[model samples]
Target: MSGPLVSIIIPFYNDGYVNQAVASALAQTYPHIEVIVVDDGSTANQHLLDPYRSRIHYIGKANGGTASALNYGIRMATGEYIAWLSSDDIFYPHKVAGQLGHMLSRGALISSTDFDLIGAHGELLKPQLAVKFASAADFLRALHTFCPINGCTVMMHRSVIGRIGWFDESLRYTQDYDYWLRVILSGIDFHFVNSPLTAYRWHDKSGTSRYLDQVNAEFGIVHGRYVHGLNGLIARIGG
Candidate 1:
């Protein structure tokens, strides 16, 4: 019941797996936590949240992209730390505890961990699917090619928002990538924890699956903006 309060923000948008997501957040081994479910105009699945109405902070807003909904939830979060759990994702019971411990132990303001990939029915497709980095340079280099850090696996201090600013609302599909690039460019170390404490569901209905072309297009724009600078850093670190 005691520790720095952790805010688990869930951006809901008609995902059928939302209830399971909320259940996982509520089931965290770490007790000092608040789950904020931002309903971004979910027409069909809003009713699924009825059972959790009393436990979580449910905010209904006009349909917005994931970035917008996350920004809204961040604005409303009162915790010292924040973590995002996509409505279709699942957080292991030790997620908050493990990540927070890893961050605090190393004096890290922001951190992300390895994650498991799950099928639509929550069956494990791949365990520890995130590429592990042997050194900081490897991680930074990986960023130039792909987003090795999963948004759902990330946890950061509230001040990170103040430093890097919120997710770019203009970016519909690649907001998380844009935010990570900004954070890295701001000279903040993105500490990586080796454990997989989150399960990312890969379903056809998921945004990444349904809009692969758009995601790829947006990723190009976001990655191009940072590749030059990140390459410089990578060169320095590798040397």
Candidate 2:
């Protein structure tokens, strides 16, 4: 089979640290990537992205949320495969190439890899393992316990996006988790790459980490929709 074209979608808002993220995607060893950076109504540090204007496809939109920005990128993308990267994260040089190779070989609809957690100073803090879900049921069962896939580490076929639909724009946090649940419920095949392919920065200033309660509430909504709700409970206890 021919190599697939991967669209890397990044959503940012007033992130002074966006340069590293953009540089990493631009530096990917995979030559078939199209980098799309969505500016989520960022007012401060707009100049931070000026250096990458020629290297990336930049889009400016109202600050609805990361989900809104990502949905916009998806609509504008023309790639056979799509991947998401956070503005605060950086991918290893060979991340795209390695993940793309695995997805093509396995014919995986959606795939993700392990990643390293880095501190604000760029020191390695911890290594996160990529959670593997054997089936849709397995994924639903683990939804409330932990996230089955890391959003930034995911690389999925275009068909998967069409089947699962777009990210939930209503979700300000845990949008990825909500999307993953929908994908799992649709019964798409998923896989995990054993190697660490990206660095997820953890700092006090990061949005998700700073507003953990909101994140938790959003996660609860997803779990309630899929597990604790009428349909979810029926799926679990009935079966």
Per-model TM-score versus the true fold: 0.97, 0.91
Residue 64, candidate 2: Cα error in Å is: 0.5
- Tens digits of per-residue lDDT, candidate 1, 81-120, equal 9999999999999999999999989999999999999999
Q: Which stretches of candidate 1 lie over 4 Å from their true place?
A: none
CA displacement after TM-score superposition, residue 84 of candidate 2 (Å): 0.4
- Residue pairs whose backbone atoms clash in candidate 2: none
Tens-digit per-residue lDDT, 1-239, candidate 2? 35779999999998877888999999998898899999999998878888889989999999999999999999889899999999989999999999999988888888879898898977899876556555655655666676767899999888887788889999998889888877766666567788999999989999878898888877887777877442554386443
10 residues in a row with least lDDT, candidate 2: 230-239
